[model samples]
Target: MGMAMTSSPQPPPPPRRRRSRLQSATTISAPSANPKPNPKAKVIPLLSDVGRLQSATPTPTPNGNPSPNPKGKVLPLLSDVGSNPSAIDYYSRVASNLAGAGRLGDFLIAAEGLRAASGDAGFAARINWRLLSRGVVAALREHGLPHVLEFLRDADRIGVHATVMLDADASDAVAAACRQLLDERIMAEFVEAIEALARFFVKGIVDPMDVLKIFVRKRDPDMAIRYARIFPHSQLLLCNTMEAFGKRKELKHALKVFGALKDQLGGINMFACRSIIDICSHCGSSVQARIIFEGLLAEKITPNTHVFNSLMNANAHSMSYNFSVYKHMQEIWCPS
Candidate 1:
């Protein structure tokens, strides 16, 4: 039984794997004092050489991937874009892409970069700013002036005004965007419009007057003056605001605003007169405004077109129409 129980001979050991030449070659080792070059490796031109040779060979895309269409359409690198590379078309596409993606703020910044890059005389002459502005305005219209206002504030938060040209052509571009918002039948809230314009002064990117002029043209001067009251001591600003209230025939509120003016030295006498006249201009059959105008004349304040206009307006609905005032105005102007 013991002899039968003896274990069978042990299985033969597995053969050792032979080291493939590829594995042997790849082993890390210190270099020889004079290393021999590998026959498999090929020498290629450096990166600088690639740029120089791209015209003859295939160039990479704007994204820096190897060109699939080397012989096909070659996109000019942003650096080499000044000449014959469809730079305008390329940027236009880029602009539209960003806007479509809702990166309206970035589109403006990109536009600035493009303009700056092309600022070199070589590229400047070819850029049609108006054409480019079409894209800029489109994005602006889509994203809205509120976004642009916020963008301007964000730029200031990061101290970008010194570097960015929001005060220059960029400023005009943004202002145009604001104008676009006006034509929209669905207007933003009165408070929103005020806050947006106020941001301009917070960073001084746009002239407040520019916006006011727009509202005046649209016959919405009151809306603009409502914005003016947000400024410090804005008597001059409130001057128009009060007058606007009056144009709505809100005489009481208009008088209240006029009284609030801190004209201690009477320096704003001309403004005071004009404001009262304008406020009464539309207030049919109002003697208060005329009384004020006469009192101003008694104080020797020069009566300008505004003064006469207000006088005519106050008398418009009464027996004393503009014609009589017109004759009186001529008498005041023309020497006897």
Candidate 2:
């Protein structure tokens, strides 16, 4: 018993070791006396960033007035942005904004800025000429003749000639403008302008024949024929011009045009043959009509009733000639 009691009293249980609350929990780092901020964390605006900021800001009204806002503190306008933007950045942003807004009048004004901006390296080619041309053509269609002429004049100024021809609406506007020019007695200028534009007809975006028709209807058949010769496969226009010559009794010119079509378009369609025969009949050239009829036969082009009638009428002075054409038609129609 004495020995057990001695073992129990041994060391009073070595003073129950204790841990403080601070020892049990995580410790926070103390603040440095001179802390350094992270340099990489700071943001510097880029050219595009500056552009976006400006674009996101409000723009002044067209009349040089600020638009009213009932809400709290109005945002700064684009004009209010400081002069930190580069020329390319500034003009590109302005042109893009104006064009997107469909503000053609404003876009034209801004295009001057874009033209200036194009002087910078790699900027001229960066512009979307297709988009630019579309905007300009839509503007022309909306504003009509005055704006169409304005666009033509400014195309060179704005460096858009290479792109303007790619747009169908632009081509239509040009045709309309040419007609206007002709109506205004500006024939020499119209001719010069159209001749220059005709080089682009191979693009096939605009039909050269449509433009030629404008001149033809304006009584400028010589110019019409000149342009028609440029696109020889434009058979309808060539025939129309030949018919015009026939109506004017210019048989030599009509025959010359018909011959050009025959040479250029690789023989003639029924329409062309009919047109030439009608012209020959009108000019009372039975020999020329007979030659054309023989050529049509050589080409294996079946003669229609109109062709037979034209051939017979061309030689109406000779009953034998008329009877011969009639007999040929009967043989073709009734193979018996």
Candidate 3:
């Protein structure tokens, strides 16, 4: 095999063409001597035609293109797209499609068309509160809290205060959602949202205490009580609310409040004193509350058996320097 091995011959190269001196001296010309300027070329009008057109035509946006009909045209932009068949019919056809697709940024151009058409006259009337609320709700669910809040503020600046508050008509559903979040302890966010709504809907006229009561009725009684304290005028309601606490074995609250009120008044009705004595007897603690009863009597009120019984029941076990006080109490009740 080594003896028969031989190198293969190389193939010949093709001959190169040579140019003459005169031909070499001549230069190549451009594709066209008089090139037509682009028919749709953009010329900077010191004031932007785009800017000028911006006032009238729906400016083509990026997310989705806008329409090009004369009614919705960017005159220069329209000519540009029409000049090239391949270019988007952005001004003519694409704008409507974009708005149809719910691309708000794109549809804003169409909105421009609409705003321009009505000269913003029918805007306030046509874009009603119901529609506005629906839009806001959609924006909130679709975008987020900040977005909705921003819209709410803007609407308020314009006069949508009534509408925003009226949305409480949807409170049942909204409140249910808030409750679930509260239970999960994810309330910070929802609380802010609700607070924003409260600020918008009930800002000046609403009593914070009243609002808290509503929440208490719906969500937290203790919190409601604390908030209720902020409203000094809630005394009447709070007094009546004691029965509710008593039913729940929270009589301490009722007694403490009523007792404090009695003490603060410095003098109360004999019937009122008797009622306190009865409460003390029921709780087996008239002696602990004796100072109040004594103070009432010192003010010329008569102490009854109910009052005497209250003292004995609460003080019987304790050693008293005046065992005579007990004798007097017994005789007072069964005086012979």
Candidate 4:
């Protein structure tokens, strides 16, 4: 011990090195009754950060309200369009523009909106139906019959009438369209299409007789009869239809048409009489042929040689009737 004390007064052990507060806190993990939240831990800002961000944003008005944007445009509502004159004008312009641009679908939509808002007040008059019809007719000429038909149906639904006079080209196109419908066996649509075509006659755009000729050529008996009834004064149509029925051996139809012609024309003409005589000859109806011949005489319609020949031919199988007809023809000719 003496030796140690004499060893440079044995410098007291170096004072224990003191740890800094940071080092002590990091190194120490002591438990507590009320554990406080970690100060150094990351803190996610909830309401405070959101509030700060909102406060930083610039408000349009001093009263914390947003002002209308000068560059933003608002479209008028369809419901309010009825009460708003400007809205009506705006939609009308839109429709006109769309139509002018050849945007048919868009034009239709705009037009429908306007129609619902405007009601029946000059609805049809306000539109250039002629122009619209031209477009549809052009489509029909292009063999777009199905599309045009659907478009017309939709237009009707929206209270838009598409009535247009069909020109020569349009008439031909419509005929072709009808042929297609018939080929497809779409009878209902075919009837409707024909009715639509007939409407052109009402407007004096197409001749009903011409349409009858078309139906005759197409061998559409129903349509021919319909148009014939519509234009009862069409003598040529009636004659042709009767001749067609006779050729097809449709005796019933031929007789029916002949009777109608007689009633409508106030009397049968020489040509019609000849046609009926020929039909009787073909059907071997000697009795009917005799009746028609007598009727022609009673009407003061002089029987021609051709009419007499047809009457004889009708009774050719009956020697007695043939001889009687020949005797009558000789008497009439000799009666000079």
lDDT of 3 by residue, 1-336 (tens): 568878999888988888876776676443777888776666332211334454454667686887555643233443343344332223323333342343324433433443343343233333334443444455445765556555555545543342344355333334444455555655355456555565544233334544543443444444444434444444544444433443443446546645544554465644445544555545656564576556755776657766655555555566471365667555755789
Off by over 4 Å in 4: 1-59, 63-74, 95-113, 128-143, 165-192, 201-236, 244-253, 259-278, 281-284, 290-336
lDDT of 1 by residue, 1-336 (tens): 456567879999999999998888888565789978676674433222324545445567799887665334444444544454586556545644553455646554644555555554233233343434453455456766566566556544443331133334545656555445544533344336446556454345345455544454455545555555656646666676566666667676667556655343345456676677666766754678667766766776658886677676667676655676677768888859
Per-candidate total of colliding backbone pairs: 0, 0, 6, 0
lDDT string, candidate 2, 1-336, tens digits: 465544445555567667766765545556788889775573433232434553233557999887764432422333332342454554555565555444555665555544553443334454455566676566666765455455555554565453334456656655676677666766566656555555443344345655665665566656666667655466777887788778877777788778777877786667777788989888878899999898787877788877777887788899987887778778888989
lDDT of 2: 0.63
How many backbone collisions does model 4 have?
Answer: 0
Q: Would you list the C-alpha lDDT of every candidate in the order shown?
A: 0.55, 0.63, 0.47, 0.65
Ten-residue region with minimum lDDT total, candidate 4: 47-56
TM-score, one value per model: 0.35, 0.45, 0.35, 0.47
Q: Which stretches of candidate 2 lie over 4 Å from their true place?
A: 1-189, 198-222, 229-234, 329-336
Q: Least accurate stretch of 10 residues (summed lDDT) in model 3?
A: 43-52
Residue 44 CA displacement from its true place in model 2, Å:
19
Compute the lDDT for candidate 1: 0.55
Name the top TM-score candidate. 4
Q: What's the lDDT for residue 24 in model 2?
A: 57
lDDT of 4: 0.65
Candidate 4 C-alpha error for residue 94, in Å: 3.9
